[model samples]
Target: MNVLIITAHPEADSFNSYLAAKAARVFEKQGSVVNSVNLYSENFEPVEGKIFYPDRQDSVRFDALREQRHHWEKKILPDDVSRHIQLLINSDLLLLHFPFWWFGMPAILKGWMDRVFVYGGIYDSRQRHENGVMKGKRALLSVTAGAPENACGYNGRHGDMRLMLWSPIHALHYIGYSMLEPYLIHGVRGGLDGIAKKEQQKLLDEKVEDFENRLTNIHEWPIIPFNREDDFNEDKTLKPEAPEYSPFVRHDPDGWKKS
Candidate 1:
């Protein structure tokens, strides 16, 4: 299998970076072909701009979707975006490694999504959701958090971790990835200042071992039960009989039956 790991972390020594490297090694050991894209190291431009298009479809107003489609049809998409898109197209499994910042992904990672998941080329109005171009591919997220794991639980001050992940998870689903259960490593505080060095090392080792196990058994990973094509009605609302996949979509567990 072809595995692509995209890492978004500013510091090379950051925990997120370490997880990306470790995951690549694990995948390779399993006889999977691995390709890693380090956003920071590659100096990838996360922001979308008119400068990327030499021939503008709309010179005055910068419509991202319209331009994305236009450029793709014209075969004038930016070199970087085209290259990244090709990588995504070829990969069977995609691993996203990043730090959870302010309850979401870092800016660069968000930027990568904005620019790389291009419209027209990757998906169109009728080609998204369950029918997305990359429908058969799978994706997994590896996120590092500074807070303790309990803090992200249902009653924790940080709110439910699944709720925090809804947006990105849904976006990946829309783009046709079988979103795998995310791998999270919490309590990744900057350094071992407050705790003893030995304890810190022990904690790090435990997390690394967990990651190794997950990578070794990636094919057995459960994909998130996202809504499917049949789940929606003609108006785009949930079908009356469709099962609920997320709290964000079906506020009440039994709400789908009432639709």
Candidate 2:
């Protein structure tokens, strides 16, 4: 099996980085070819520039701002986005590793998806009825969060961690990946100092082992079933839940008093 691991951590000594390295080792031991892309180390340009447009041939004449807008609209061509597409096409399993920042992925990782997982590679307007290019692939996410499991609940300070993963789950499912249950390490900041460091490492090692075992027995795991109905609930045409408000709320006492 060919596995591609994309790591989005800036610090070399970060726990996320350590987890990524351990996961890589396991894949190698399982006789799988592993290709790792360190986004920060490679200085991957997350912003889509004019270079991503087929129509904008001259780099000298390309407008960076215009290209940025075009990328947001998903209008770039396949050849322009070939490098990242080729990486996805060559791998059977794709593993994403990142630290949960403010209950979401780091900006760089989000940008990677914005640019690399483009229209032709991961989605296509023409193939609305059929699975896109990445169908039949497998994907797993490994994430580390500073908050404890209890805190990441509806009644707690931080909301459910699983809700933050909707983007990846829906995107991969739309493109036809057999999604594996995400392996999340909560309370990553819990054992940062003193004797807890050893315990933290041990716990991380165990999680890595589990990740490897799952990959080794990929075939045995039940594949994610494809159901168009599940994608969109019939009863609820619109998700009624209020849009998540950021924790950084601007207090306005006068406004509230008037109300």
Candidate 3:
């Protein structure tokens, strides 16, 4: 299995980076070829603008959709974006490592998706969801949060962590990945002084071992569920007979009205 591990963190020696590095080691132990992308270390750009497109279709106005398609067709994407896309095309599994920021992934990783998951090359109207060009691929997310595990759960202050992850869940699913249940570590506090530092280091070591175990049993990891093409109606609403995998995918046009 070819795996691509992408880590979005600024600190080179951070616990988040340690997790990412441990993940690579775990996969390597299983004889898998691993590729890693460090967003911060590599200085990956997350913004979209006309700067990347010098001779775009319209110089004045920048339409991401039109331009993405145009650039993809012309094979004129930016150097980094093109390289990233090439990596994605060659990999079978994507392992994302990041700390939960603002209830979601860091902006740098989000930018990686925006720039690398280009409209025309990565996805298009006809090449998305169950029929996405990236079908037959797998993706797993390992996230760390500041609150306790329960605090990020169903009735916690941070809300349902699964629901909170819908942003990336849907995004990856939409792009045709067999999403795995994310691995989350909570109660992650900063430690830079005295006994707190020692305790944090201990916790970090334990977490890395947990990640190793997760990777060791990776084949047994459950893939997150999603509806297939048949699960939706012609109007693109969930079929009444289909299972509602997501709370947001209910068969209720009026449910929004009630909310």
Question: Which of the numbered candidates is closest to the native, going by highest TM-score?
Answer: 1
What is the TM-score of each predicted model, taking all chains together? 0.93, 0.73, 0.93
Each candidate: what lDDT? 0.86, 0.70, 0.86
Clashing pairs in 1: none
Q: How well is each residue in 1-259 modelled by candidate 1, as lDDT tens digits?
A: 9999999999999878988999999989889999999999999999998888878878999998899888998988988888999999999999999888899988998899899889988888888877898899999999988888899987799987767977777788788888999988888875566456576668878989988997898779888887777888888788878887776777466864564
Off by over 4 Å in 1: 251-259
Can you write out model 3's per-residue Cα lDDT over 1-259, one digit (the tens) per residue? 9999999989888777888899899889899999999999998889987788866898878898789889889999999999988888899999888999888899998988888888988898888988887799999999988777788988888787878899988898888888999988886778568987787778767888877997999889999989898998899988789987777788775774574
The residue ranges of model 2 lying beyond 4 angstroms of the native Cα positions read 57-81, 128-130, 220-226, 229-259
Candidates 1 and 2 compared by lDDT, better number: 1
Q: What lDDT tens digits, residue by residue, belong to model 2 across residues 166-239? A: 67766676666777777788877744777787877787678777767876676776544434433434562323
Candidate 3 regions with alpha-carbon error over 4 angstroms: 192-203, 252-259
Report the error of model 1 at residue 74, Å: 1.9
